[model samples]
Target: MNATVIIPAYDPEENLQRIVDRVWDLGNHVIVVDDGSDISKSDIFHRLSEKAIVIHHEKNEGKGAAIKTALKYIKENLWDCNVIGVMDADGQHLPEDMEKLVMKANNRENAMILGVRSIGEDMPLKSRLGNAITRFVFHSLSGVKVSDTQTGLRAFSYKLIDKLLQVEGTRYEYETNVLFYCAKTEVPIIEVPIKTIYHDKENSCSHFHAIRDSYRIYRDILKFSLSSFSSFILDYVLFCILTVLFPAGGVGILFANILARMISGGYNYFMNCRFVFQTGTKTQTALQYLTLAICILVMNSIFLQIYAGIFQIPVYMAKVLTEISLFVISFFVQKKIIFRHKVSGRGMIKE
Candidate 1:
């Protein structure tokens, strides 16, 4: 299978050696990145050097950097390697599980394989709670549902190395961004059920700062959501105000709807470029956004007609339904089309 296993170790212990030895025994090459662990942990890496290619950083970088380091090494040196595996060094992942992921990668045409764990009572409480709270980050932003958004155990073909390196994130958020990258690029994610092994149930060795790193992963989407919500409030409130001022009927409602959208859409476009998506107001991007806005406006009018004109529902209730229905579609369109990222040849995000 010509697979290479990459383990990013920070103050790892006996299990690191065990995983390396077992992977080597299974006939897979291993690359161990010493992510600036203390001098006390040097010996473990030294011993691993005999069984694997050991790369050390003088200072601590994050897990994302370590994985990129190993990927770069593979892309430069090991051209024959067809499959690449990445796993945590804290002993939560079993070598057999890694083998399953690698095997799955080999069979898949163009997809990243995830060794997804069952999040339940058997797992850490923080992990369980985090997954429960944060799966929305994936489904809401990318319009893709991933069972394990933060699983460290992942395998992909050498072909995806460039795109993965291009994904932005340095620490824990890197894993989350990788999933987003795959979703963006139309790379399928194949999840394989793996054993959920938590070596220490309480106070685990994971370096994931739950609150801090989670914010990094969710920050962009959170800001965009707030921007969208604020824009909707402006749109709806102004629609109501204009309707009252005219106080006509269906005709007044239509006029108010268009007027409110023009105001709120302008605010949304500004906020998305300046604050939410962080994109420049290039002409092409502006044109694309305008097209989307027009399409959404038409869709909004149709929904309002169905709700208010035909069904005789209150215009107020119809406005809420129309906005809610379009939220996900509008967000995804703006993200995928209007605010797309550029990828460099060596896998860096240019903007």
Candidate 2:
């Protein structure tokens, strides 16, 4: 299969030549998306164009935008390319490691290949912490454990071209968003070992702003979690209303309990369908609701029976404890299975 290397460059006229030479030497086609680099530096991309294709942007768009442009160009031109790989222009990724990534992509052909970096000596402390947090969220939300979620060195088959084009993030966060979209679509992904090169820190011109951009990444993960939190609030409110209407007698307690959980379950289903899953929330139909209620009833019975037997806790107090436990499990399941959104990022140099 024909392989293509996509490099998103911003004012990297000097570094561009070095990267282009390495990629060209590998016998792969190269596409450089210039995110509004000045024309006076034309000689750089112009020189590389002799060996590869160079597309220039008049205004500086985000890295995500540049990738979209390059992919679109490939599709429109009908290039006979199969695998597409992305790398940074700031010289952070080692050229030699590209072989492993390319080979892995070729082998898998359909799976998205992530080049997991071997974080060795002289790694920045802030970068380390940020990558760790991103990795945790990716695993927790999507059930996919990745060591480096923010690595720029990733390879994908041309079949994913249409999928990547459908993604919305226009900045650095776009990388993470694509991973989420892939997870949502159930596309297979694999991570391969690779080496990273950190130049004596002088050659890095990364625009990633840690604090500001991290907030964006965190905000994305929080969106999927809203359904569970919403269910908890709904449950509590329903319980309060039921208790107000009927005192804590046998009949009052039974009716109140059933109604509270039912209302909360319905609300949770509604929100998850429209907002959280972004797919049809009603996919489960009435049977799904009935099944969910049955599960909740069974859980409630077990918890209430255990509490009544061991501890002399009141029914209301036992119910509260059961809800709390369910909340924890619901959050984990919603993130990991139902509304799982995998996110990966290399941090942001800009807000």
Candidate 3:
């Protein structure tokens, strides 16, 4: 199988030439993207250009943009290439591990292969903590358990290139976005255990900004939750107003809950469709969303009754608890079932 390796470099370390030479020894086409490295690094790229295909960005666009640029060049130039591998320019990813990823990709058809690193005591505390938090959040959002969500070593078939290129995020979050998109689209992901190597414990050569990039990585989830929160506020306000305006009884509570949910659910659906999920074919998605809303409405009313009537919790408190519990359920259902797109073939959604 014809394969090409893409290394996205941004102010790389001094050992770049060694990394390129090692990758070249694997007998695959190598493409190195210089993401606007400073003039001091000019000699490095200049020397490496003779050994590998080098693409230069006028300015630092971020790792995702660099990878996209390499993929674009490959699609336009290397028509015979079937597999594309992406790895960091730093020496963290061993050449042997990448070869294993390539082998795994070649064996599997239309799959994205990830070189999963075993997080051990030797790993930096920040790296370990960051990966742990990201893994948990990713699993909660995408329903996919990935050991190493931030690993730079990954391989994918050419068939998935177009979809991956279209994935949102131009920074560190781009990798996380790829996993989310793949999980949502039902793209097969194969994980292979690989070696973990950190250059420096405290101050690594890595360019990842923990705070700024973490926000970017979790941006999608934040947006979705914010939309839900806004709808919740509207729903709660309407429910409170109706409860005050109506008699205190089962019939009154049920009536108020249904009306509140219907209004807020409609608003929530509109926001989710336009911003959160961004699925095509509103007819089917709306139907599914409405069905989900009805289900949640029933559950919400039951919980409200149990909390407010049986447990003697205040009606407002019961409503708050019930909605909070239902919020988690709603997010999963919408992500996995309601807004998931059905691809025709090879799991590629058309633009």
Candidate 2 wrong stretches, greater than 4 Å: 11-13, 36-52, 58-60, 119-122, 180-188, 199-204, 211-220, 249-254, 283-286, 297-323, 332-351
Tens-place lDDT digits, model 2, residues 22-100: 9889888889988898777778888878877888989988788999998998898856888888988888887667766
Mark the regions of model 1 whose C-alpha exceeds 4 Å error after superposition. 229-264, 278-351
Best candidate, TM-score: 3
Q: How many residue pairs clash in all the candidates, one count each? A: 0, 8, 0
> In model 3, which residue pairs have backbone atoms overlapping below 3 Å?
none
Task: Write candidate 3's Cα lDDT for 73-186 as tens digits.
Answer: 999999999888999988888888888888778877677789987788888889899999999898777776778898999988888888989998888999999987777777
Worst 10 residues of 1 by lDDT: 342-351
lDDT of 1 by residue, 160-191 (tens): 88888898887888888888777766777788
Residue 163 local lDDT, model 2 = 85
Score every model by TM-score: 0.76, 0.77, 0.89
Kindly indicate the candidate among 1 and 3 with the higher TM-score. 3
TM-score of 3: 0.89
Q: Cα lDDT of model 1 overall?
A: 0.86
Model 3: residue 67 alpha-carbon error in angstroms: 0.6
